[model samples]
Target: MGTLGVLGLELVQMDTPPTTAYLQIYTEERCKANCLFCAQAKDSRAGLTHIARGMYIPADLDAVVSRLKMAYEKGYLRRACIQTALYDKWWEDTVYLIKSIREKSDIPVSLSVFPLGDERYEELCRLGVNEIVIPLDACTPGLFDKIKGKSAGGPYAWERHLDGIKRAARFFESVGTHLIIGLGETDEDAVKIIDELHGYNVNTALFSYTYVPGAQLVLETNKEESIRHYRTVQMARYLILEGIVAYLDMRFTDGALCDFGAQRDVILRLIEDGTAFQTSGCPECNRPMANETFSMMYNFPRKLNDKEIASVKKELGLG
Candidate 1:
């Protein structure tokens, strides 16, 4: 039996149900990369069952695929996302699994894995994969090195990941990247990276840094701080991605974002629309409570109403 996300299990059991379903498979082998925030890290106490703040229960691959196919046929499963841990032969194994799923179901697949070169990209394209996500989890190179690079004794290099993102953008129409907030980076750092990735026509998936129970990183930020920082970054990301603002025009005060380079009215109008606060991930995927509690959500899986919009504005200091 392979591990499945909470949503995946819900789909299989037909619980409250989600519009989209994630197969949410992970590589069981121990990861070579020792990312400090990751539960799969070599030194982390978390095992294969714990990932991304959710518990993954064991289930058979074929049975999971069957359930996914059934859900798709019923119009409940819109996409399948496969997350991979860095391990020896992981690439080959992931490729095989992708092919297996494609053969059984027609659900569009999104793969979140380590940066692979052009040959592998072409192979995935040939296999009918929808998109590729290479997570440059840290916003700045300094932070990256400290948590996921040489300083952390990890295998990932900042330069190499950037190159891979560029390459993937050239190959896939819907290429994407992942960034984790609260990793010792400021709002400016996060927005700058988002603006840079926008240049390549690449989209980004934002995740808040949630401390896993057995992971090394301590969960220290309070609710108000986490909400404020995340809301600011999300607004900045949306503005940059939509081409409504540029990083050069943005003003920062001591590494904190102070101005979005747009007029006050324009910014307020955008904030009121509330699309900026929704979850950011693969196309058609809205992962509710993926990184925060339901009461204090970092990203809303659904559209925000008036009250919710007001709360988001308050958190962003716009109210």
Candidate 2:
């Protein structure tokens, strides 16, 4: 795992090591929620150590805290991201980890967890969590219910998650949520929800859905279609966030993004550097290869090269 490599717990090679130390709270029990796509879902048979493409082997808490301090100082990492899964001891584990990290380091911490109460949010803010992410994971309530909400046998509710994100906005300066693409949502659906959240000051991180072996749900998303959809949505997100175009101004035909509704030059100029296609989320969180393969890099960790820029243009129908 990239975090393990940074902590000197393992020898692994990454073309670009994650700028953020991606650590998941270690636990033997499966996550209580049954998000169908997750490897740690309640009824999942997949390895508990796997999250998307990252294999997070458990390590010593004190050692990781020590290395994290070193990594932050040496500029190997700019942030610490702690991922949480629902289980009986999640709160205790999360608190302990945050406290431990705070004890040794002042590096900004990002906590990616599901919806929690204000009491928990206030405590996390007090513990120096710079950002809090409550992942909606789906673009619409129908899709959310089918996969990560109650219909999927999960405890998450769309309304409750939105409330929690809004609640976090009041407590944390940077509030974010995750929305995984390629999960049966239209481009318009993705853009609309993103804009809606943006109206509330919630930043959305985009992820392409991956099929992990032994996971509960097996989906066969069309590769080219998903890529086109993701590229369009990525650029559109940049446009909306930057005020180049509002979601309402965008044209959609049968749920596909037809026109960006911005001047072609404006769009072209923005995409020239390819920050539009980089990983999105809390500041300094470049999740390199977290949901991508070498052949199909959805989110480039660094700046895009000329060839990649050309390819991205073609993918987004810019050229």
lDDT of 1 by residue, 1-319 (tens): 1223332543344222344555555566768888988888887887767776756666677777777777777676688888877777777778777888888888898988878889989989989889999999999999999999999988899999999989988778888999999888888899999999989888988999988887777757877877788988998899888889889989999988888899988888988988898888787787655675756778777788899988887887888
Flag regions of model 2 displaced more than 4 Å.
none
Q: How do the residues 1-319 of candidate 2 rate in per-residue lDDT, one tens digit apiece?
A: 8878877788988798888999899788999999999999988999999988778898888989999999999999999999988989899989999999999999999999998889989999998999999999999999999998889999988999999999999999999999999999999999999999999989999998988888977888887898999999999999888877889999999999999999888878877879999999888888888899999998888899989988888888877
lDDT of each: 0.81, 0.91
Score candidate 1 by TM-score against the native. Answer: 0.93
In terms of lDDT, the poorest run of 10 residues in model 1 is 1-10
Lowest summed lDDT over 10 consecutive residues: which window, candidate 2? 1-10
